[model samples]
Target chain A: MQAEPEGFDRVLSSMCTEPHPVAREAAERFLATNPGDPGTYPTVAELEDRAITMLGDIAGLDDPSGYVASGGTEANIQAVRIARERARTDGIESPTVVVPESGHFSFRKAADLLDVELILAPTDETHRVELDAVRERVDDATALVVGVAGSTEYGRVDPLGELGEIAHEAGALLHVDAAWGGFVLPFTDHEWTFAQAPVDTMTIDPHKMGQAAIPAGGLLVRDEALLDELAVDTPYLETTSQATLTGTRSGAGVASAVAAMDELWPGGYAAQYDRSQANADWLATRLADLGYDVVDPTLPLVAADVPTPTFEALRDEGWRISRTGTGELRVVCMPHVSRSMLESFVEDLAAVSGRTPTAVPTDD
Target chain B: MQAEPEGFDRVLSSMCTEPHPVAREAAERFLATNPGDPGTYPTVAELEDRAITMLGDIAGLDDPSGYVASGGTEANIQAVRIARERARTDGIESPTVVVPESGHFSFRKAADLLDVELILAPTDETHRVELDAVRERVDDATALVVGVAGSTEYGRVDPLGELGEIAHEAGALLHVDAAWGGFVLPFTDHEWTFAQAPVDTMTIDPHKMGQAAIPAGGLLVRDEALLDELAVDTPYLETTSQATLTGTRSGAGVASAVAAMDELWPGGYAAQYDRSQANADWLATRLADLGYDVVDPTLPLVAADVPTPTFEALRDEGWRISRTGTGELRVVCMPHVSRSMLESFVEDLAAVSGRTPTAVPTDD
Candidate 1:
């Protein structure tokens, strides 16, 4: 049977990409181990710690307290659970979380699961959370104020520092969903990490842009004590308690996260960000020249107002693309997305739209 | 860096075992694909459906509706979420789940996360859930009644048929957590599957006894309508809604599950179960001859009332064993466990207990 597509060739608009060779090897070597039972698999457990330390370094935390989660959804859910539990301890009934309208949909899942009221504060024209709206939503029952760092739709980073201040003022914690942006945001001037804000929790996925294998999502808390809210007593195991959402999880993600971070931390990731950002800019310029409305390429993500017919035609031509909620064609410039691929996609777009292709200047 | 403990040697307590060779290769091949976005990765998505179909066959559900979950914890959590949502629709505000005392700890995590009350029913002398206790605890508030098929502690299968009747009478759904038993129980004379019982949902892990890679837990429902309760709108993706708990999950698990199931279904799993059961029986006899109180080998799991000092001493001797909640030493005879390995473990037990080793007749 045809197991896989031809090596992520026509894949775009996906946060995941091809795993690094080191990460693939690491995942294979540790595939059989279970980090859930740390006592049984001490090797992978150590790797998970190292992966967290590297994530801490990237997210600007001195000491990180978290585990490698299934993905951004699990990480985000755990963050909300922590906030809700803390609020319950404070005798707050019907705890609520104020989140940006541009936040990931996992927040809605968390709200439904944890019985928290989700207050969606509108985002500004730039797609960042409106600080005033967040301030207005905070109340005694508010447990958390969430900010999106590298949002899924527009790749916008909210003003996390200001959001943290507002949340703390209202006696609520701040959580940043940096699932997609955490890897590249360090090279930029975005103040979205623990060092930059009073961020109680953060969801940064290694599988997204960290070049680790799939399922390497990171959830870092400012203090280890914050994890106590999510801990459940684990019986018949060596560990006393488990804070993760899933039990008997694979060690592949942990080992791969460590391997990928070790192979491509500051220098390699910086170079990748530069190339990807340049590709996004190139694609955005090409689309704009074609008279299409485009969102600014904030973090290697381009959303253009391509017509539905043109979009469908391009898709029929074998270009894997998706449309946002607002009907704008979205394209994420992941690591596998090269200049040639973008050029081909633009050519296909021009062909489908019956527009002349523009000669965009290329750095490479 | 010592990546792995020398190939599952001395590891006698964990439910996870080494992945089948075909499963490892399949996982590596689909390491980067995300089954979460089925529209983007159709190849792996098809494999996921095939995996579910195979899981349905094993679980005795002819037309199963389910997804490959991260692990048993996620599957169990999703099942609870479904029950809670359905109960909410039925106007039950404070939903409770009646789980056996021998149930996996994930139920507690599910209770804390899903805002559902957890009611732990006592177990009988054979380690199975007490039917009378379950009947007494289940009321209008009970949304779900959980039965353990191959429990974590003693590998005891609860009376799922009777539990289903009780749950249905109370207007509750019955969920079977067969995460470690689904593969082997198909070969046993246990009335624990969907065909045998009125099981509304089931948690069966391919990573456990299925010999697939980790993070390959299966969640199967009796009907497709049950998944609607867990559905959440997913924007900017090929699919409009997502029922899975985590987003952007790895396709490795799905591919590996299909590969493993295809490689070892009826005949292979039957042979393995026979061998593992024989091994458990052999170990139980050896321990009983040494004057140790042993729980019968109900399902390839042996629990002996070894003294705390002896258990600690055996652990110090590098035997990776664990104690159940009642302080009995527990050993699971997984697929990786062999006759020689059990013999060696018995030898170590005798050495630590200062007793003469008894020669047990071996089938091999």
Candidate 2:
């Protein structure tokens, strides 16, 4: 067999990280099982229920109705499908969804697939969706209004509560894409959950920051009835109706999600958020000290204004980094990222930029 | 953690089977890597390319253009999306798709999500799709015509060459769903691939008869240009455009597919299919001798007319089996199935029906 690929030790730009030990074990155990046929694989189905319950607790919903999606893209697409169906029932001929320009590209795919008009609302100075712009785009024909809890390019949380109000006033539903922020926002004071706002649906992925295996993306709905729009009558298998986008999904992701949440929920996730946030802050301070423009570390993601040549040099030096749409260097401080790794990155950055290292007092 | 779910010991009705040992090892090695961002994870991305090449060789396409989908559902959905986009370019505002009544439920989900009209064509007495019904239902607005290579209900193959001709006559694309039959059909005389007909797209799942891990579904297109309709601009990622439905897909499925195909291609799959076909024939003869109506054992799947009470008793006795839409007991002889297992099932079936077993010569 071919040698295993390089580990995630130097991957600082991706939202995904290495799976938790328990999550890996769980995934291996259930790798061959299919959770799509719930009646045939009852154990994994029950595990999926437990995963949803735990996710509901974190998202501030007493009762949650959702499934483990293939990823955040599937969850986001399903949310749009529900909104479109609801609007069709209310006599809307051509449905439209208002999403921030800072939203992930999955919304664009959803708009194209579902044949809904996509209206991109501008963002404010903080990189959050502009409230005036969102209000202007949403009208009576709007089916859904999307808000990003922690955006991909810039880790800025949108005003979810006010976005919900604007959507509801226009007879539309609110969907918050918190795929990257759901695991960390519980440690902060962000009103981005079902309890704080009238969020009809939310996308929270376990594989991103929850340290679960890949494909464990969550799609939570405030009411179970919302899933009825996506249901299709399954003739042959055990289940009568299936709501998920993909049939024959593996039980590995469902089991891994349950295992990861059981191992680290409120306490472990809180500590991880603190460490990752501190690392982002440290990197931002170092970059600013070097006379580079840096975005505020609202979450655990940092963006800095490094020259194109310097960014290319850093990448050529075996650092798995990426850049934002506006050509700023972007790095996501996932759980696998450590303080020493960031220090080494700074040394490389200093060398690539041809600048002397700043002398600072060491706490240790 | 909770005990692992029951193994696939008595699972005789599911399309999925236990993963090959090599596939399991490959899945474990690539569990945390995301193939969605191919620039960061080049190893798994190259493995995905290898998988597509092998799939193309098996599907009779020299140059296949597709990706590793989450499962057959996503592949089927993408096929419909491609056809719909092509039809729209031809000035068709409201597109429709014609599928056999025996088609998988995923097509229903696709039609609903893509906002297309779904017209179900009647099936013939042999459980194959009636070409006349498909021709009568198709119109200028029809975007695609779907055919089943190995149907989920009765393990029947539709006349793919004729279906393609009828679809082409109506200016519609032909999509063959060979998800369950792709692996075994190479050993048979079935004309269900790109070389046999004018098939525009095909869905073949590695997790099914290919003995790979779950979520290793293949979507093959004859021409690369068909994928252009699904592309979306990915800004932050290194790749400029992505055509996949999911954003962050796991590399486990991609690596497992390559490993499984490399280990077991024509020779190994042919031997296994021979053994499975013999087992299915043996079971079908035993049930027929017991005075029950039985469908022909086509493609290693047997459907028999067992009484409802007997079927319930078999389930109560822990035999993992399912039924068809017409209520015939269905048994799919997967790679894990053995002759002794079928003999045990027959003994239980005889007991449940209050019948004495006939003495037959055993080929030990």
Candidate 3:
């Protein structure tokens, strides 16, 4: 097949919002120069193998057999679907899905889509899943229990090791929704690890921490046999070896993911993680010293407990802070964030919180 | 936000398999040169208006309103979901969906996912939905009746005019799945016009004939109220103004789709339709003259009835023909299909079909 346009044209594609440049360049290069034998329209099975192998390496899992999906939501939906299907196979009619309150909203959405009953397990004081609360919710009717790695709010890792023990004891499949933290956790907070957990399935999105591109999500299964329940074989596009909700996927995305995986593994991840964490720590210290309450003092992500009117004051100081619901501010110190930018942001935060300057009319 | 990379790097990104070059370039150019603005993220309402305006111009629906989806399957699923929701609104508890066997399998998958009972409406001798059978299947419990425009099998369109009457008389919603043929039919043979039919909803994929890249599927409804039933609002993502299965979409795809519509609309489709028809006709004639059975002799897509042995023999001749079931051959004269290539394929077909060449001696 003719190669898709690269560079500016590649970025403009409506197929995906913002594909990673390096990944896209790799795809274009592959197109310009055939990587393997020409004439074959690479089989879905081969792509699946490459993705599984690459994602497995990233997640610290061995042979993570799974399917590719459009995004985290789709992956979560499919994982839930499989969880329900597996329940049915094990002779349960109506299955309940136990999820933490702080878990990804995708679990609830997936439950809604699957028509399964949702049981929200209470979170601990730290805004992470409480192991005992989750244990109390599991029953013979429970299909799956979802655990969070790094939650969107508070940015604290859940006690998966404790939760996994509870889920396994109850005979329910434990699904780790690591969509946000899956790509970064391996390299962050050395104490945070999944070496002891019996995680049946997990979701990983490269679009977030891996920072490969948009529209990259994976549902990884520890054992291969679990896929048989969700396996769909179609004449046109079979899921015999593919991981997707839809057929006829853009090979360009797949190629980019592979390249992104190559760039992110090992040394690159450790360095990037440390940088983001350092930036987060620096911001937290500065914000706290300015008399603002920094939520989750230990976590890399910090939220400023500020009055609603404070947003205007901050805006005047040229600070681009995000609102974390009512009376709070949220700031993300991603890998791309530099120390100078953090210092500037901190300075602006202080100026905004310290005194009111000359009024600048708000756009609204 | 910084414009994502394009070219070889982009293609390797996880966002998409292929990004439209021109559209990608245009979007990147716009982003690079323009200042940041909130208008960059179009609201759901704005998207609905744009879709309605575009569909009204192309499909000739006076009050066309639509919601975007990632792919054709999602559009079909949403359409089915809405149809069922509408049925419930009309006081039908258990809604039944009647679909032709030739329709895309997404309907069946959606039916399974939505928990709606599926009734396979028997088709006529031509594999089109039999109107009488569909009429018989409709009852007070019937939710929707589906019709396919340009089925993947033979590129044959169902008689939507007749089916529309049956659905209307039975008080069931009529949905036309025009995902494949919507962009082509307006410019193809007007004799098989289903454009004037009473379709409550229709799906069209820009990535196909519109050539806007991938993952651009839309569900256009004559009555916008139907979409309201599927509308969901979340605090994180603003999906209020438009309805979609997703929250954070690749805005890049939307831009490209808009660009593609502008580029391929009006007289552009005329050329594509003409070329495809000519190629189909030419190939069909050549296949029949060479003593091969072709499905839907009058259609643009030819499915050659060749034995497996014959197919494998022809495959050795460098023809990458797709096979359905045991021995059915499907040939599509897509937009990029060149005339000389088709002629060359025909010549090679004649040589391959003349006689099964003896197997050459090999070391194996």
Candidate 4:
């Protein structure tokens, strides 16, 4: 009964990425295919193959083993599953994973699902993992050390190279949770890919940053054996072996990610990233000028210190915003977040903050 | 660069269900929506709410708590997670899940991911879980008992009401894997839902029988607290609690499922189900008359005893037939499997079985 949904044109606190025009069509094109049963749909299977390769190249890997999953949670779960399987092979019982508090809640779900002990380490004031704290948590039972790139709260990139070295020295796997940063970091000087460290696995959400449709997360591993560790023989399927967390994944997601990469590779995404960063920077500057404390965004996210009442007030006034770990108003300037929208938001923020409303001349 | 994809006009041997026309359009309309992160898109979240309600009602649930997930694997995983959590709360350190050999592979994935022991119960000749074997497997450590509503190989439904009694008596939860049967069982006389048993949870795939687009599976729990038991606090987002296996789920999936239910709820689906049964009966009768051994189909599915060479030959001829566990040729007569397709398939099968091809007068 509902009509076509318009994109989130007015959403500013949106890590919920929108599909690019071409990627949206790509999703429609392959909606009927399931890559999990590849034999029935060779075209979609080949598209998935191409998409994974393009993502590996973007992740700075020569050759990587991976699959297009539902989202970051599935990928993160798979990454930790591989780590636990490998750890078990080396006679490690009661596997534990140490993740910073800034890590995505998917890690918590994974720990709960995988029956592993989750050691949540404390973060610094900036919400970056304290390496010393992580070090204290790592032990012989530690199977994985999770580092976040583009921490959801502040858009802070963790020291992955340092964590990788620490994990390797402790005979543990280093997994970079870069679901929100993978597509943009390639355009920046930041190196969160395999080239920067001996990272065992990484969770990259094409849905989040590649501007693909929902359910296009990738789990890229350094070795194919990492994936094989989860592979189980399926006597019924023509594929003979199953490795993914899902049995019947939407091939449309894989096709859309491929189209997204084809349309917005490193260069195209660089331009888009520039636009997002500029918008974020502009919003931060305006908020700072309004006397509200703001964390300078690392990517396209900004967290402004605002009281709970003011935050609730802005939302009540129809401004879409979330809060940070410290209850600060958070805004993610995605491509959908326009300058006019940001300006209007600041006007509302000024009103809620009880500061002299930054008087932008009203058109009315 | 790919153009609009054609629907499965030529696909047969496809157990993979196609979305209803209306639901397909619904998915396209809400392609940009993300119900998981609902701050940006509230309409899609509302659609998800309605879809879960309709699904619960269809499953004979009074008030069910659930989420639209990627597929049956994710739903099955979450169901197992809830069972494990409840078991752990009851002081069972190591949990075990008893599933019949006929259970879908997702149970295997769930067991592997959740660090639980999977005890495979033996099935009778008809592929129904033997209650005696299940009894042998259920202990204090048994957290869950899995009963398949529709076996993947055969269209056989297990005795869920009986299993439910055993599970409840043993202080274990009963979970029905109705990924393929949720939409059909209600239309039939099968008592596989809550109406028949004290079923704690069920995995139903809207993508499969509901005829929604890909990646619309749901895990419906008996109570809200059962869902809350798995929900962890995600402080950054406006929604404080998170329970799904995915974070940023495909809003399109939720939309499509809602649309599917809206378009085909009960009365409308009965007509479709009737057509499917007729088609299946036609195929089974023709095969039986042709001296081919066939299992009596319970739903819109047929399994015929065919040799390995015949199976390969059928695939070589572009007939999309699969094999049952007993090495029988399997065909799920979905909406796309037309009468002409079945007649052509039977003709080929006759030739493959070294019998004279059925003679039919050509239109010409």
Which regions of candidate 1 are displaced past 4 Å?
A357-364, B1-6, B357-364
Write down the RMSD of all candidates, one decimal each: 3.3, 3.4, 6.6, 3.5
TM-score, per-candidate, Cα-based? 0.97, 0.97, 0.85, 0.95
Provide the lDDT at A85 for model 2: 96
lDDT of 4: 0.83
Alpha carbon lDDT of each predicted model: 0.90, 0.91, 0.62, 0.83
lDDT of 1 by residue, A1-364 (tens): 4566556777887899998888888888888888899877878888898888999999989989898999999999999999999999999989999999999999998888788999999999999988989888999999999999998998999999899989998889999999999999988888887988889999999988999998899999999999999889988888899999998877889989888899899998999999999999999999888878799998999998887888788878877889888888999999999999998888787767777644342211
Interface RMSD of each: 1.4, 1.0, 9.0, 2.1
Candidate 4 interface RMSD (Å): 2.1
- Per-residue lDDT, model 1, residue B129, is 94
Q: Higher-lDDT candidate among 2 and 4?
A: 2
Against the native complex, each candidate's DockQ, computed on alpha carbons, is 0.72, 0.76, 0.21, 0.60
lDDT of residue B304 for candidate 3: 73
- List, residue by residue over B1-364, the lDDT tens digit for candidate 4: 6644435644555556677888889888888787887766788888888888998999999877888888888888888888999999999999999999988777888888888999999999877889999999999899999998887888778888889888988788999889888888888888887867788899988998789999898888888888987888787778888888788788778888998899889887787788888988998899777766788888988888767877788788776566765678788888777888888888887776665424441211
Ordered by lDDT, highest first, the candidates read 2, 1, 4, 3
List runs of model 4 lying over 4 Å from the truth: A3-7, A357-364, B3-7, B357-364
Which whole-number lDDT from 0 to 100 does residue A228 have in model 3?
A: 67
